[model samples]
Target chain A: MIRHVILRVMAKMLIPLILLFALYVQFHGDYGPGGGFQAGVIFGAGIILFALIFGLEPAKAAFPPRVLEVLVAVGLMIYGGTGIAAIVKGGNFLGYGALSHDPVHGQHLGILLVELGVGITVASVMSTIFFHFGGRGRKDV
Target chain B: MIDLIHIFLFTFLAIIAIVVIRMRDLFAAVMLMGIFSLLSASLFTVMDAVDVAFTEASVGAGISTILMLATLSLTTSKESTLYQRPRPLALVVVVLTGAALVYATFDMPRYGDAAAPINHHVADYYIARTMDDTGVPNMVTAILASYRGYDTFGETTVIFTACVGVMLLLGGARTFYRWRRREDAGDPEPRP
Candidate 1:
């Protein structure tokens, strides 16, 4: 990983922008050709690139495996919670129309939360898989 | 011009596919697969399926390629050379399956046929009512998130299940490494 100054420099410049673009894609999905799935992959790719160029240890330090494991379930819970909230509001399961007084607002909020859940799970799972694969070669487990 | 672009892309795609199949080098094949994914993404973009294209580019080209490369590093990069054994029965089965698939395509509607059963089905209702129902401008998002939310929930669960499966299979790295270390302790150093 060392001795590639150009790659390191370029990576440093691009990683932040890539993560930012992922965020934009996640939030702007309502009006654009992007969403949780795309945004999550992009974000995971960013972190993977960081791990590739700077070494996996630093990446793992930044995003630990334990935290990633927890996040995998947390995202699903958030998604399921949104559905339960709808059920509590007297709407059918996953019916965002009842989340708020205004059905439209409720739909918006539900979509946002659900997408967030997806993004979190996807990003964490991807990074977690990468970490496990990359760490396999190293002596330290 | 667009047709020309499509033709060029498809040509390259075909060439890459052939090369990938014929090449014995696993690394080159993996890289070519990434290119194939990228070309498919471009074709999806040309067809106005930008969301699909995005997913193809990211998951297909990006993550899968990287994962394959990682696996290559852990295993042999070059494919093992096995003696060629031509099985006529296997070839016959594959040829028959391919011919059946091609034959089935004849009864299908032409590309992007507006009157096709799929196009005339609930797609029209979703397109017309997405904005009104979900207040979302992106009809695809509206459909996936609200109209067919239950299905998406199932899909999300599927992804979570995949992660759990992979974790169960690969997450015992530490324990495996520890066991290997214990086994190695009894053996003398055999390699430089």
Candidate 2:
């Protein structure tokens, strides 16, 4: 640890805000300039900042590698599953029209879910890459 | 005013690119690359491509900079000056490519030309129907997530594939650390 009190205090204050902003970007994509890809990177960046300030072990403790690896696959599954779901409902692949009673609402729901899936996968993969990269050459694994 | 901003940003971009190319310190080059990305992101914002700007800022300036710094720490911060010989062939190739690109730009439609061929194609339809079809206010999102859902899915899959590839190569972090430790301990024939 750097023993820099100001750095610690600022990081503590900023991490939550970064994460909240990422979620805002994620769900607010329909109304704004952000979406799943941007949100995921922002979210991963928040975690990376945490790791940078607090050290890798503590950050890994907060977000285990096992959980991150699982989330990576789960996000892709959610995306693919959404398409399969449309097929099951007798619509074309990734056709949001049949996901609900109202076609417009179905589209809305499908977009939201799909964006969520993208966000989750991107976030986890980014964090995983950072973890593995940062872990190299350290005596403690 | 926007044109002035564009010129100013481009000037800075050119300066940074030259400086990055000439810089011998890898750390400084990485920082300059981040600045370059930030400038391009601003340019994208100026052009009303907010989504692209957001992505460029995050992925280009943010994540990639950090990764480069991390890699620098793991390796050397000073770029090796062994390849200092100037190659005339390389210069000729680069100049030819640059000239060709500049020449091709002459045929491009003026910036923000509403009647351009590209705007007349599917863009007009998407712009008109996005709200009705997807009920999303952001046309970019509507097109990405609904109108061109297959493309977005492919992009997501690409990201997933990149992650899987990285994980496969670097997943064995413990093994890597162990190998490093053996090398540090002066083992001539360390186990693979």
Candidate 3:
């Protein structure tokens, strides 16, 4: 596939900005219109764009398939673990108020943790799907 | 004012839907569907559902379009030209379903009716106490992550399952290389 010089340079400039925005969304979600799910998809979209612009091999090298497989499960585990943490702290399942001495603090922390988990799972799964579909059928891929 | 926006968005959405159905080329149809999603997302945003709009824009316009394009690249770009008339039974079924849905909608409460059954139900409590309870200003996130955490967890699980299923069915990086080698060895390209 013939690559475009302008597109590659443009993607290089934009990729980090996209990633930073995704993180901003993930963290600022408590007070704003975005959340883990939206942030994760946006993050994955950035990586997918990287894959599209600079061949699958380079993208895969940057985000290894092996690490992706582990990260996929790890994100879900983080979410589940947060729930269990609340349970062990004597609250009901997913009860955020039990994690800290102050109930509101617990809620804030719990929301942040689970949102991070959701973000990780979503971003990794989306990128993995792209890698699988994007890498298929090419000799060099 | 909102109603006017709703009407305008719906008109464009309907036009896009018809164009998608009438189109023969699969790639063009997929692109049209992306536009359809974008319109719907805008409608959601206009209706004060910013969270839903964000998801729709990212998932519908961003991810799904790219995924569809990737799939298209792997297979034939143009749709098969074997045109077939729509089945009468399918059309009847679709019309019946649409009628049933419209009939059901007539019995539904008016938009944002404070006295509606759902409004008086758990929704009122969620709205009233979410701020005190969750500390998060975004009620949607609070409800999704804390109040209705189990449901969100299940949704994430479902998406995770889908990814695993696709990876299994499609094989992996190694298979693609092997298939290429076979093609280089003068073997016929796999039919699928």
Candidate 4:
């Protein structure tokens, strides 16, 4: 019980900090050594920690499996949609310069959209994996 | 001074790898593998490949270890000694491969030569045009998300596929929920 309480408190404190760092990494990718992939993993780690401390049931209650499943598909769709949009704009798939009238702005928008997609998919998939493994029942103590 | 530290790290990494391979306990081996990955990430940082280092530290050291532990929980942790005898044919093939690799390295450019073909041609373009192209200060990010975006997309798809496969094989969230519901229904009296 004591261990559970401590874990809960620690999860509450650490998860927020991790999430904040993930956001920092996501937005600051243009200036630093981080981007969508790293940020996504970090964010996912936060959720995984919460799931670990709290029971998988509670974690599932917090973020339902159905929601995560949708998020995963939606993320891919967002990424693919952006690429398709570029193609529709008369450029190669994911050719962001054609996204807008101003090529630089188009590039920025493209990166942001794609990064968001990557972050969402990675975070959802990772958390889902954690739930699967940690929630598994063990016959042996 | 940094170069000395790097050499030390490399030597330490080799020692750790040998230990991990020789270790009889699977759990200990998995933990050692995590440490090995972390050391490798640090080595990548020392080599100035911070992006690769970050990926290594997160995915390699974190998720991979968790996956290995989960697998261990589901299976026997015993190390099978069935194939303990070293095969002469395998040894000969390994030695030949090593010799070929070493010979190929001699023909390649020395460690950090700026005039090397890698630095002069494709790499130079990314380093120079990254800022202009993607408006990102991190050239690696620009390269990964833009110039080599196809590869990144493919990798992401691979990760997604693997996760889907694992979920399908291991009984996903739906099964877990059903199990919980059955447990709840079995209990007639709700106890706080």
* CAPRI tier of model 4: medium
Per-residue C-alpha lDDT of model 4 across residues A11-109, encoded as one tens digit per residue:
788888998998998888867898888988988877777766765677788888778877877777778888999999988999989999988778888
Candidate with better TM-score, 2 vs 3: 2
Off by over 4 Å in 4: A1-9, A138-141, B172-192
Native-interface RMSD of candidate 2: 0.7
Select the stronger candidate by lDDT from 3 and 4.
3
CAPRI classification of candidate 3: high
DockQ of 2: 0.84
Candidate 4 total steric clashes: 0
RMSD of each candidate relative to the true structure = 4.2, 3.6, 4.2, 4.6
What digit string (tens of lDDT, one per residue) describes model 2 on residues B22-83?
99999999999999999999999999999999999999999999999999989999988886
Q: Report lDDT (CA) for all predictions.
A: 0.90, 0.92, 0.90, 0.81
Counted clashes in each candidate structure: 0, 0, 0, 0
Model 1 per-residue lDDT tens digits across residues A1-141 = 656899999999999999999999999999999898889899999989999998888888888889999998998888999999999999988999999999989999999999888888898889888888887767765
B-chain TM-score for every candidate: 0.88, 0.87, 0.83, 0.83
Model 3 complex DockQ against the native: 0.84
Model 3 TM-score is: 0.90
Ranking under TM-score, best-scoring first?
A: 1, 2, 3, 4
Scanning candidate 3 chain A in windows of ten residues, the lowest lDDT window is A132-141
- Per-residue error for A6 in candidate 1, Å, reads 1.1
Q: For residues B1-192, what per-residue lDDT tens digits would candidate 1 score against the true structure?
A: 999999999999999999998999999999999999999999999999999999999999999999999999999989998987999999999999999999999999998998999997899999888887789999888888888888888888888898888887777756665667766897554432
TM-score of each: 0.94, 0.93, 0.90, 0.87
For model 3, the superposed segments whose C-alpha errors exceed 4 Å read B83-93, B172-192
